[model samples]
Target: MSEGGSVKRSRCFPAALLAVTALGAFNAAAQEPPLIRFGRGFAAEEQVWLMSARPELTPNQGKKYQLKQILFQANPERFQAFLAGELDGGTAPGLAVIFARAQGVDMKIVASVCLEAAGREWFSTTYMVKDDGPVRSAKDLKGGTVGVVGIKTATDLWARAGLLNASVVPDKDAKIFPMGFPGMGDAVRTGKINAGTFVEPFYSAEMARGGLRKLFTAVEAVGYDHELLDIWFGEKFLKAHPDTVRAFLADYVAVTKYYLANTAQAKRDLHKAGFVRTPLEIYLKNADWKRDPAARVDVASLDKLSKFMLEKLQWLEKPVDVRQMVDESYLPRQ
Candidate 1:
């Protein structure tokens, strides 16, 4: 009887040890921090690259969540990456955010990245006309073509709304053309297009080139200063790794606060982050968009903008729940 029991115990001991080893391997794999692949547009938007310059701001960045930032030209391309599941999160305009949700993209507005406030703090988007050209107002664009970074984008929406507000009908009084920001100024100067949408670094360049005049800014169309673009995260990613995202948001808030407080220094480092190809002096002279250091978004403004998308612009077939699309819980406590 002793020999039989001893043999049975030896056999079960090996099985128990093997199970313990397998469980340890599984736990180790689970302990690996989540990798967050994020994207951004221009030098001013999101500015996630700044985090790399100041690692101390993101203590949990490499420890809890890995960040990969992609530079995109516009929000549409960023959303394309989101659609292909290539990006976990990135900067997206309110129009694109609504369009994505309406089309079942499953994204949430995590925080405010950049916003155009009422008044001349522009550091925002600028709509420019030929400097020496006869076109001065939205009314002057009648029967002319207007260039936008992309159709159905913030630039397009603003241009349309701005023209309409001036009592000029878009696509009727002025035709909308899709083009890149860099080419817009040249196109306007060469007369291929009537006007172009301008953003930082590029806007300064155009102004220096000596032939573009400001027609209007984003505030003219939105009725007041509003969010131009915001940080968005895939709903799936947020669910799969909530704690990691929280850490990332905390880092984001820190860096943004740092950037807002030290605008000049932040712009100086813009080129270091692969954000600016232009000279640092120009970027220093211009400020980027304004955002809450706490990363709070204007829900009322977004809700109103979504309504405009549905009614005025006919950009949406149905209404989107802006409030429901915003997830502020992931933001670190201020």
Candidate 2:
């Protein structure tokens, strides 16, 4: 990617032209690092947020590889970007991973960003309904509307799975409407929608304002622990820049380690980076997303969910061999 240090020009070239061309090429090469175009969604996905916030922890950044992060409001569009060849890789939900595989995209899971384990104390996606609303659980949602980030997204999948488990058909028993996370609280509160998915900063803010009750978490809806979101790479990109990818992932894990160890400071850095805008005290009091310090992916959880989507949810056309799609070589050594 660096063009191997220097260029070799033929002896026939004029001295002045050769020097100018060589110098210009060298300077251009030096100025341009391999751009890692990736997409990121909001809140507690420290891999993207932390890496940019704490550049010192990522030694290879700007030298070996540069980042061109494209932000998305939700996960489905991010996956569309990856499949459309717009991003090298970034955080994506396990459902998106399987969906990509089903669509014949050759991408590999490189590392873990976060998990939605059932019993994990870390922050997970919470579906909220009015505390005194008529609907109480998945079973009570018949003829009601459910708001999510998008159809077939992780939130939508969980919402549908929860409904199915309760013997309520998704589209027939309850409707799903897509909207941005920022407005979910108001939608549920004003009775614009019966229930909706709420992730971080918004979740806490909405709860503090009162009038919402937790219907079920992502884990509870899906009925097990699973890889919620993970870092991934296109197969061709991984093959072309294995060292660059490895270095980026190494820094990625380092940021995770640094964040877990120094959360308050990390949050302060995030505040400074403009990722969060709350008063320092409020941001610090918010729960952090559950990230594995070692950058380990729950491939088994992915596999189980893959099977569930294929067999139970009828979301996938064929079985996805999640184990085969995983490539942990990019991660820092244990």
Candidate 3:
């Protein structure tokens, strides 16, 4: 009888352990918050905010949403991922989104990511050349090649516009060569390209390398305050999870405010993220962290960009309805 009782107790112990394991899993599942995958660009400012803000904004009982940031090397990749449903939402250039919509990709601009504010130079793409290189101005780039991260991207368009502002006809006088952002500084440094367009970390990195100077920034080329990047969401994601989207925007706004307020912490986060190689002060001085907490999408600015893409660049076949493409309802309520 003692031997039978010992075997029975061992079997009961195994069953009890299994019951506990299953119950723990069930409780965890119940507590897991809804996740929204966000595709972000490879900019230092954005990365800093993403690193610092995600923790503060998560697990809100009132919001009920969690954010998962997905990094993309370029806007095209991010846009493609959003189209394929790999990303719930992400940022894309206003022109890129407009062009994608013209091709039937159903997406909406939920908020502004980066913008050029009047009397203040927010983060803008910069065109750079060797400090002592022969090219002194955009006109000097005539008959030579300029490296751009991608064709028809904001960087590319901005470079072209800079050249045009200097009375140099792009593609006619100066040519654009596609190169990765990581390689652009080297390309210009080694004389592989006459000039290269760089954004944030790359711009800061190249500047820190001690042999480059800015020919012009996007703000100078555009001649007015414009929205450089915008937060967007696919139609399917919006339809399935509107509340989650709203919650995310609310959290995102709070995160942006936190980043703007605590720039020193943001620089440390950027360094930790492997975006900055130089001292924290180098990044702090070079990068501009000026995002509004409201995340407002500037319709007039977007419309102007659309018009520029359609008329000046001839990249878009026609103008897109900037108002229709923007959905302001998802922005965080004040």
Candidate closest to the true structure, highest lDDT: 2
Please report, in order, the local distance difference test score of every candidate based on alpha carbons.
0.83, 0.84, 0.78
lDDT of 1 by residue, 293-331 (tens): 888888888988899899998888899999999999999
Residue range 1-334, candidate 3, lDDT tens digits: 9999999999999999999999999998887767778888766446324533446543452347666778787887887787677888887778788888878888999988777554445666778889998999888998989998788887788888888888889989988999998899889989999998887666777776789998887778888777777889888888888888887777677767766777677667767766556666776677573576687877897788788888988888866888999998987777
Stretches of candidate 3 above 4 Å error? Answer: 1-32, 44-54, 59-63, 117-121, 273-281
lDDT of model number 3: 0.78
lDDT of prediction 1: 0.83
TM-scores of the candidates in the order shown: 0.89, 0.89, 0.84
Model 1 poorest ten-residue lDDT run: 40-49
lDDT of 2 by residue, 110-129 (tens): 99988886554577789999
lDDT of 2 at 201: 85
Clashing pairs in 3: none
TM-score order of candidates, top first: 2, 1, 3
